[model samples]
Target: MTTDADDVRSFDQRGGAAQPKALSAIRTIARREIAEQLSSARFLIIALLVVGLTPLAVYVGARDYKSRLEDYNRLVAEQQKMIAGPAGREVKGFDVGWSEGNDLAVLRAIRPPEPVSALVRGLDGALPQYWDFSPTGIVTGPLASRPQRIADVVGHLDMAFLMRVALGLLAILLAFDAVAGEKELGTLRAVLSQPISRAALLTGKLAGGAVTLLLPLAAAFLIALISAQLFGVDLIAAGALAKVVMLALTAGAYLVCFYALGLFVSSLVSSQKTSLVVLLVVWVVAVLAVPPIATMVAQAASPVPTSQYLETRKDALDLDIRRQAELEMGGVYREITGDPEGNADTDKYYKNKESIDRRIVPIEVGYLNRRRQILNEIDRDAERRAANQNRFASLLMAISPAAAFAGAATDLAGTGDAQYAAWLESVRRYQDSLNAALFDDPPTVMIRNRGASFPAELRKPPTVADLPSFAPPRRDAAAVLSRSLPAIGLLGLFTGVFIIGGFFAFSRYDVR
Candidate 1:
């Protein structure tokens, strides 16, 4: 304690009392804080934990990414090969026509996992990695389901976890006693006799605390990033350096938020023990409690209809349309072919029925149109309810800087919920294009006697090389930064508000 006081006093004496500057005092305090943080055993422990755990996480995640990419390539290759196999290839007696080959929708809309996921696995669970498509339509596989259990609590060891949870706790450790600890040990009174102002003291602690917290995390992140490249991830080589830069800045903001909160609590409490307790309580509420509680409240307030409800309604409507279409098409086929009572022969009767089914497929489009409209209504309703629920969560964002920072980092990294929405829309558009290519024309059916419907001579299906390629949309840095501006603003506001509060509390704080 006396050494800390002497450290500050000696700096003031070196400059002489006649030239006691706030800048000098603040710098002195900041340097001293940095020295102490580096020398502490806790700093070594924190450093080892981050550096040790992060590369292992990256290595594991990178292996999974590599595995999934190989699967995607292999599946795509097999699909292309099968489509080029044979014309009139029989699948359950349905002739694979030239046009049918052109409409081969065998490829799954599977996006390879992003390499940056090693750093930030944001919203990856909520977004599907796979989707299946056939000529009729495409179906998105369900998002991964995680069992809610205590073992699943600290789920992944990505950079998000390191920053939001681990670094947050580390920040508190560095800051919980920034002011109160000094005061308790008889250093505060001696230090205040120097040129330092309360505002300068606060500023020094904030700056030094932030630097101290970020150094280890940044070093560990860079090391793990290189380790990932050794395992063939190559995130930086893949032009993700920009994303990594933004992620680091955003993560730094989160660490600073927690550090400032600790400083604010330390300033308000008179004792180090009391300050530590209050900071811990605030940390628990902000980190653990707010998110889940907000989610439950939002869900209750603005309920979205279940997926089963939508599917059931869609199926029932489709069945009704099919039944109506059959009745209408039966009448039309008779008028065109004049086969009424001409079905006297059993062979004629079967031919007439086949003819009706051929025409009915086209007529069914009208009913499918109606079904799409109803399903669209269901979709729009659900989207509206979800938007409302998001607004409610935003209210919680106002009070939780941790939430704000997490959101901003994820969005900027292109791994947030917004990114997930964008990916979904892209797939939907691709599906619409695929549907148009397959179903826009009238259905062509084969007669029972028309042996060898498509020539067995044409060995392969028509080339689908002209089809548009599905390029997954890329997230632009400028656009992402714009979207995340609000969250960044909140982080800034929280830091400023807490630091200002700390200044006020420390201005009149008893030093003796």
Candidate 2:
């Protein structure tokens, strides 16, 4: 009366002779599972859902990317034209004078849509598209002409979304009945009557079900890539293709994790219906609920100031600094003109204009520099807080395989938060260059008859060609892979944990 465990031990002891038999048993079981899945109505329906929705999602995403690209080009052209000043006319360049009324020279750094956004939208639309630079600091806002619609708020359907929601659900459906349903049908008892080990049986089921789930996904993914390329996305580029491959691998791991989880649940439960119910609840929680709930929790835990609050604080600081400068300049004016009220004779003011500017320019420059320092501090503080909040949210969301896969997919596509941060860093570098070109040379300020004026030489602004232009930073495949590796590793860990759990639970599962 040898138990199944004794049989497994004996089979292992048989060594070389038993190895081929075990492999053949696993292969046979896998083939049987694959045949059963392919003929099932539920599998066909889900496969059809994925195959049909993939093209539609890609088409919609491509069209949206085209619109954003068009808007980006138009804004960039306008920015260049403005920087060049009015054509065919003699234009006064920036008035680099210490006058509160004079506007600072402003430049715009616009971010173009990532080409791979057609497959994975990530933060492309939500992130700031353009940043306006001034001597004061950077100001960020969306294009006023293109307001965010409901669709943008809800999010666009892309390959990542389809993988997380549709394919993930499909994976669960494929494996939810893998073990328990066989037990209920009395097929498990018949299969276990053979010399096949439980480990081999589970492996066969996992491999076959994975194939059944992944075939439609792989086909649909290829079709989506082709559709994106046809719509003018440059997926054929070496770097882009590599990222696409990484994205595909991420999607596969994500789906397999769900399948493994289903298999684990099926083994743990005695009834197929109970296993499915439990798996569906887990899917809803992991896929539909976790990421957003984690974000909200992180936000509440690590509170950060809003952009509007930061902007208001900066504006108040600017006004206070400006008022302080005005008071200091008033005293200088009173001293120069020998008037308590600070009213100066037009003739005397002009006569002493050079001396007045020599005295007052330094005072104005000091205040301006002080304001820049304080505003920069505010911006840096806000950025730090935001980064902390984001990092915490990411850690919490990584608990879900769906979120992990999405993070990896978006990073590979160059449409994730990391890429957006890189764009912002480039904008900051441009701001620094602009500051060096313009603000580093302190302009003299002359107060005459209650008006501030600059020297004739200062009226001619720096050459447009000499000014720095915004060039978006590009991340190579290596950098993207580095960013995506953590998420990929997490997905792999999830798959391994669930598969191990399934193996352990199925070993003790009652087949009688």
Candidate 3:
């Protein structure tokens, strides 16, 4: 009994000789907290839920994208058939009544490029270098084509919906209880009583909590990769992988900021219940309230209507084309002959007038072109201003945890407003192409006024190969990285401030 007593005394002496360092104490506290969290049933449930639901969401999104892609292909084929019929041989709605010599001359004037379908499909950035001719020898435009429809669908859901809603919600769930829950349990007093500095304790806790949260995030990344492969997505380069990693890091930063906010709330409130209530309220405002409100404000301020409105306007404009054609022919004839008044020499004047009208065909084409430009400009400006509103809202909400998640998640998913901006850019490029094709060399029209032989002047129709092709815009990785820096920096600063403040608050805390 005496020997055992002596051994206990010796061990106590050794322990006293080497007192726990401040960092060591803080680390021990953090370790204990981490262990406590892992042992709790809540952590297990969250992990299970994330792992289980992620696959289902990815699978559904991929399947839908694939379905749309197939439908678009069929639509393109049907459009090609419609464009290839008798209408294909007509030049701007003018029927060809060519004499044998004129027919041969018209056929030679415009021959289809070899393999014209490739250019029409939008696979090539411009018209194909070659085309193929039909047996009838009628020149036709490239087959109606567009990028695989699946590309748009996958781009929408993969980058936007998944990143914004999924990872963001997960980050919030992980962080909400981080500091506040500690105050709920009675052990917070014991933790603060240690000799360690408040800063060291806060740092240790943050590091430990991060490790716990990141494990599942890593799993989510693996799932995303698998989903991408399963859906036959061209897993080119490491772009997708990098995006996923960046998204996870952004989510982690958002949660870290929230964790610090929760700690601050906990420090101010004596009770955990009040801290939780405050945290939830903040979530509601930031996540649920702010985004939609921002969208509404943007729409009201910029006045960009839905796609339905644009479609209706387009239909109306199409209906007035015949009237526009008449105006164009009349205006061109007046401009060319320099005669505003009617002439009495019907036979001679009419024959000469047809040639003059043909020369000024470009004027009519220009009028049609300008009208389209005005509508496009309106749509573009409205969308640009609305996007600016959304960006402003994101910056303002960086102060709140909920807003942080929304911004960060969207950045990660690559589906945020930036995606629409890319589409706009593509449309602009397409417009430039249209200008090059049509306006650069406007067509001349020879009117046949008398019921007789073909008009003395001949005109050729524009070829489909001459039409512009659309190229979709892709985001610059560097640009996205730069945009994200502000959010990350602000969150980091907020987290540091809360951690330091919480440490000091706990240091002065009374432990009776």
Query: Which one wins on lDDT?
Result: 2
User: TM-score of the candidate numbered 3?
Assistant: 0.67
Residue 360 alpha-carbon offset, candidate 2, angstroms: 2.6
lDDT of 3 by residue, 128-222 (tens): 11121111112223322234467543433333234344544544454455555565666665666666666666667766666666666567656
The CA lDDT at 225 in model 1 is 74
Q: Per-residue lDDT tens digits of candidate 2, residues 136-228?
A: 566675842354587666756889988889889988988999999999999999988877899999999998888887898889889988888
Candidate 2 vs candidate 3, lDDT winner: 2
Q: Give the per-residue Cα lDDT of candidate 2 at 59.
A: 90
Clashing pairs in 2: none
Poorest 10 consecutive residues of model 2 by lDDT? 87-96
How many Å off is the CA of 215 in candidate 1?
Answer: 1.4
lDDT of 1 by residue, 263-369 (tens): 88888888999999998888888877787788788888877778888688767876787567656654665565575622223444355555544554456555544
Candidate lDDT values, in order: 0.68, 0.78, 0.50
Q: How many residue pairs clash in each candidate?
A: 0, 0, 7
By TM-score, rank the candidates, best first. Answer: 2, 1, 3
Off by over 4 Å in 3: 1-23, 68-185, 234-237, 300-302, 306-360, 392-400, 433-438, 443-471, 475-512
Q: In candidate 3, which residue pairs get closer than 3 Å at backbone N, Cα or C atoms, i.e. clash? A: 113-130, 113-131, 113-132, 114-130, 114-131, 115-131, 141-464
lDDT sort, best first: 2, 1, 3
